[model samples]
Target: MPIIELRTEIKASKEIVFDLSRSIDLHKISTEHTNETAIAGKTSGLIGIDESVTWRAKHFGIYQLLTSKITEFERPNLFVDEMVKGAFKGFRHEHHFEDLNGGTLMTDYFDYESPFGILGKLADKLFLLKYMTDLLAERNRIVKDFAETDKWKKIVA
Candidate 1:
């Protein structure tokens, strides 16, 4: 398994960052390169505890479907989404937010295990980890953009 941890400081309230982080609409915008879309379950809006979403995305030149459910959620604080079905063996993404200097410190703890045993390990060591990290970093950048400006109003209420 490989883990990607990122801490992003947004000059915005925790509530704003938290909600923006869970916005499906914002996700689609940030991942336009991957053509990611929520095709089932909670397709739009802020996803909450017990909510699931099926995402269809183009990754590595192939389209894949991944279903993830929010297993944990605390308003304006923390949330955890775990994969129900996907290309990987499994994955868990935990989003945490806290107040800092009148702003919010958003952290992502993403852990994932790929399929195919040794081949998967090789992939992680080769390019998968960095690829995943870059993907998350770009997503976070978009979240920061929305949180720091008036853009959030369009996606988060």
Candidate 2:
């Protein structure tokens, strides 16, 4: 299992950051690697604790459909989603937020493992790990950019 953790501070409210983190629409806009949309579950507004959503998308040229259930959610603080079904053997993501100096500190924790045995380990060592980590980092960067830039200013205002 490989885990990636990313943290960044944003000059925004905790509520704003938390909402942006769970926004499927913001997610789609942030990452070109995914074409994701919420279907048959929580609608595209904001997802709270215990809310689940299914996403259909293509990753690495492979079409994948995954359902994740929210297991832990604390408003403007923390949220966790665990994979129900997907390409990966296991997947869990946690989002955390803390208020600081009139801003918010946001963190993302990703833990996942591939279905393949040794092959997965080999791939992870080669580039899979770096690729996936970079992808998530980029997505977070986009989120930060969107949240800190005029994009969010207009929306939040």
Candidate 3:
């Protein structure tokens, strides 16, 4: 298993950032390249505790359709989603948020494993890990930008 932890501060309220993070529309907007969708469970609106969503997308020439269930959720504080299906041998992502001097402190913890044996390990080491990390970072950047924008404030308000 490969684990990744990343943290970043955003100039937005915890509620604003946390709400945006759970919104399917926000996810689609942020990951436009993936053309992702919510195929099952709560297909729209803001995700809440115990909700699940399936995402279908293409990455590295692989068409992945993954379903994840929110195993843990605490409003404006923490949430965790674990994979139910797709290409990975195992996958789990935890998101955390904190109020910080009128801003938000966001953190992500992701763990996943690719298919196959030695080949999977090699791929992860050479390319997959870096690619996935970059993808996560880009997603975070989009959320940060959207959360801090006046447009977001108006929408949230």
**TM-score per candidate, in order?**
0.98, 0.88, 0.93
Each model's lDDT: 0.95, 0.80, 0.86
lDDT accuracy of residue 72 in candidate 3? 90
The true-versus-predicted C-alpha distance at residue 131 of model 2, in Å, is 2.3
Instruction: Single out the weakest 10-residue window by summed lDDT for candidate 1.
Output: 148-157
- Model 2, position 29, has a per-residue lDDT of 71
Pick out the ten consecutive residues of candidate 3 with the lowest summed lDDT.
Answer: 148-157
* Runs of candidate 2 exceeding 4 Å displacement: 153-157
Cα lDDT of model 2 by residue, 53-104, tens digit = 8888777787788888889988879999999888789889999999988988
Which candidate, 2 or 3, would have the higher TM-score against the true structure?
3
Candidate 2: Cα lDDT at 20: 80
Q: List candidate 1 stretches off by more than 4 Å.
A: none
lDDT of 1 at 6: 100
Candidate ranking under lDDT, highest first, comes to 1, 3, 2
lDDT tens readout by residue for model 1, 44-154 = 998899999999999999999999999999998999999999999999999999999999999999999999999999999999999999999999999999999999888
Q: Which candidate is the best by lDDT?
A: 1
Candidate 3 residue 43 Cα shift, in angstroms, is 1.8
